[model samples]
Target: MESSSNSKAKPRSEVLKIMEGLAQELYAQIERGEEPVLEIPSRTLSNTVWDPKRRIVVLGPDKLKRRLLDMKESKRFMQTILMLKLIVSSIREGVYPTIRDLYYNGKHTITFRVPNVGAVRENTWDEQAESNAAIEDLEVGLNVLREEMGLSADVKGKVVGPIVVRSKGFEIDATRMGDTALGLPPNPDELDIVKIEASYVLVVEKDAIFQRLNREGYWNRENAILITARGMPDRATRKFVRRLNEDYKLPVYVLTDSDPYGYYIYSVYKSGSIKLSYESERLATPDAKFIGVTTSDIINYKISSDYVIAANERDIKRAEELVRYPWFQSEAWQKEINLFLKMKKKVEIEALSTHGLKFLHDYLLEKIHSGKWIE
Candidate 1:
């Protein structure tokens, strides 16, 4: 299967070549009697930088070297090499392995006698996190996505719209999915967007709302694409949204609850989180706007006090952090966040049901047509 139309993942042949090159470099180091070292861009928080120009978080120029000769780094260096071997094998054998599968495939115990001590045991990797970290190192070092390397992961995104996508030589039209939405593939980058006839894309935070809108023919009525990742979006969903915004120039609107968590989710879709800044260029849609169930909505839409939930300490803390983010510094966002803080209250998207089940349709229409959204 090929990568998505706009994905930066290298072709399979190129991915294989890159992996081969990496292995050859290590082999050459061994032949030359030099300590083999792998230089990877650091994924630390300190290395994550905000690119004002791009309006996205990105990795700064910081590198970490894992040297085989160093006692502290030796284990990680070996793990990286092991992961590279497993990934290369998978690519050549035409087998797709999930991250969990890779972890189990590489997990093993080693027992050896110490010079003056009894036998000691060590595991290749005790947890999936270690193997996942190794995979990420390979991804960043090789400049190729894991999806390009034939790795798979759980996909949570679903879509329904006036669009057509091709996966593995099979065409799937989003508009004709009946009562069900098209489930996004594990690697959305591999799905080729065949055709798009939508004016805009509406991204919902809740799956139930997406289903509600789809079943109610929201996309049909508005001539738009609708998508949801259930909650905080996965990488495939984020990348797909980015493609729609960047490749198709579709105006993307995010609808979420009025809480800090919801605001953070929208931020992830727009500017991306600092933890995964390296993937921001491909996954983040900087132009995406928030069509929220904002704190103001509680007052503006006459949402009953019974439906408004009081914010907890966690919500307060998250709101404070959001206020300081570079992207959230806009006057509109500041007002919304500050309002939420002052009100010490939050409301769910379903709170709109207080008016009527069909009120959500009108709310969405007003948000889009009246240009009532925060970027």
Candidate 2:
């Protein structure tokens, strides 16, 4: 039960140096006829602490030992070593690979043979999910993101705005792209925001809403950048939104359904998710405002009750849990969560269709101008 103050994380170069140091230490141990022991942070949730001040989850220095002599531990040790070699070697060669690429490329080296019996065994990392989990474990141990290690996930999400980007030997003017919105690049590390001439940033929960806005030329009319993560925002989308706020100094507003899940989506952008909370400092946008389709909006807009969906058991449970979380305990947020629980109902942004196809568009402009948002 110790804090993360024991040690600080390092940059990518230092991470590579630490891996090399570990490898060298193991080599020295073998040369001295001793068993090599690898010490790494335990990725167990019990060992993870949510730091309220920093607003991110961090690992304690509760190191677990893996010795080369143990049979069960040896299999994991071998897998870790192989993966480490792949990562470090790839970085050295200036080649970045996705987790899936690394899995297929390194899966063959993971096969093992039984002593004396000669039975060939395989699957140290049986599937891509296993490899992905291992990568997360490595991140927790190293206290750095995989992207920093010259690795990236398949990109998700799309953006359209008066923003210009220069990266990977190409320049793009998003506003001049006409109707086609830009798909977020896989390697966002190279993307340099050349210019952002938007009044504010709008982050929507659903792609359908994003498309509706885009098709109606909402960004053109409002002079705002529009973005969507499809459903749950990925690291790339979150980071991009953060940049729109931090780099461009634009106010960011989230538009989501009047449901618990939508609330959680807003929370993810503002406070970061629990799983990837270690990188919250870079991912979370604490300044983002929640401009929502709230419970009162249904009544205020006079949407018929027929379009309203009953809140399922799971929705209520999630809202209850979120209301107790430290990050969602603010008076405004608490009231919203409480109202949803009290009403026991939910409504999507699509319900704005009751008035017209473009009602939601007008709603956004009105909300922004009137400063009707919850932080």
Candidate 3:
């Protein structure tokens, strides 16, 4: 065996962290209208890792065990350059942005990058789950720094909002902007009660839901903004929620399904999602909540006629246990949970449309005339 200790290649983690920080400095230097003194190191394509698919060296210097050890710490970091190459290459070749967002199901994963500022923030980031930490933190940090050079997460944060694809075969989102529409007195930051207008809002989870309501003429009549997250809630959704809280003076009422996926959806909305753009975390983390999918709705609808989703044992157990959780004990959540338990079947807002034109008119009328519908 040869002595592979004299390798100069930085560990994937170290290299990524180093390059990312440099990239940001280079980026910031440019932003400050100064010439960027960037010296992107010339890392030899030493095959430290293997790649059967590309039939090429995923890592350099196949004999360099030292670099291999660095890779062991973070597989995604080592793959950053490769990931960037693939992404930029794809972009240059005109892959659709939405398609790019969904690109990591095969050889990689899509992740978002966020950076942690100051020294102590490292510990704060480390506390997050490992997989989440990698894709959402360090990897995200590196990617976002590069992305931030062009765009922003929000006007205030100056953080880069990018969907990253990790070489470790994954994806992440790194952004930190809240909806400006959900709060009172017309502004969330200012918290002005005077700007408060409506008492509640109904947030649907899908565009199909919104479109159905609109087609049925519920949108204009209901007088409540019927917006869809179009799947997972994005920055736009957060801002909308915030605006509801700040500007609209409306109690934002989420209307999602009774499934685990829906529960996670609600969680992401209220709390901030994880940031995955750093090696050891050089960024921020956000958390959100899911206030809808009340078990009570499942119970109230009388699951006798057209109600039947075989609840997995896990689903049954979770829905039962969720009711006991303190947060769900709020008057509304409690009521919703009870409804779900009683029926033993969930009522997706989408289902209401099956009742056709009558359901839309009734649901919206109920919403507008009664504050309870939203609250």
Candidate 4:
């Protein structure tokens, strides 16, 4: 499907202008006999910092200088330039290409001979990782999201709620989708959120649970929007949740299993992940709450011991790492992680079914209404 003409025009012009500016800088440098360089913010773990005030991870003040004349940086510089050209060409041609499509489009072998050395062959990029890195570099360097450049990625989020959104000139009402849901687009920012009539947003970690709640009409009764990314969330899901909270002032409550992995999912939604800290400003929902299946619930809710799973070494290690995150330093989170470590036991949200299948609805209402969630 085509994007709405009005929405497409602005992003196309804006991104092209930014790309043009980068090209102009390089051309002027070459004309003056100076080596051209691109200074992009360093996207290293060491350069990712937690902002205490903003309550989110952000890229630190370190920059990498990619100089065309430097041997070590030349290939990466070339890759970035090639990606820029490909993206610019796509924008001009009005064709949206996925990252994988760009990777194959740009992949080719170059051969050249050196003194006393036979012909040497090198690939433009050995793998998708290399190509994706270049795309990310362009994102940081140009201060533009790949979505703005008409790039697409696999979208994995779906929602059912009292929300109405307009995408590509088509209006979608989540409440009217019946057993299905409104599939989130790759770029949620491009969606025109026309209306929201929900008291809160319920973000379920597992798609099955999301489906159960949707099918049971849990959202309709609670006046909530139900969303799920299936597992670890993608940028579109995170961004869409952030918009719901930031723009519409809806409280976001994440429901996950009572384990380290589940906690980490909530962390990614609320505080942003370490690797993609640069996107936190647009993606993280600082006010999102963790509402369920906490380690303590295992005992409080009288979940059957048979439903409990012993915390594996990996789970313990992940919980330890989470304790060190700045956002997880809250008193409630501290207590929860410490308890998980001490008990070395975990439980799933389905364990609540020990009471009844419909008990999940009661549990959700209890958490939100009683203010029994951790930040």
The best candidate by TM-score is 1
Using TM-score as the yardstick, the better of models 3 and 4 is 4
Ranking of candidates on lDDT, top first: 1, 4, 2, 3
- 130-218, model 2: which lDDT tens digit per residue? 67766766666655667767686866678898888776668888888677789986545447667778899999898888888888899
lDDT of 3 at 225: 47
| Model 1 superposed RMSD (Cα) | 2.3
Kindly give the stretch of ten consecutive residues in candidate 4 with the minimal lDDT sum. 1-10
TM-score of each: 0.94, 0.83, 0.44, 0.93
Q: What is the C-alpha lDDT profile of model 4 across 1-375, one tens digit per residue?
A: 222233222366788989988988988999999999999999999999888999998899999999999999999998998888898888888889999999999999989897899899999999999999999999898778887787888889999999988887999999999999999998887887777889999999999999999999899999899999998999889988988887777899999999999999999999888878888877899999999789889878988789999999999999999999999999999999999999999999888998988898899999999999998
lDDT assessment of candidate 1: 0.91
On lDDT, the leading prediction is: 1
- The TM-score of predicted model 1 comes to 0.94
Clashing residue pair totals per candidate (backbone < 3 A): 1, 0, 92, 0
Off by over 4 Å in 4: 1-10, 113-120
Pairs with steric clashes in candidate 2: none
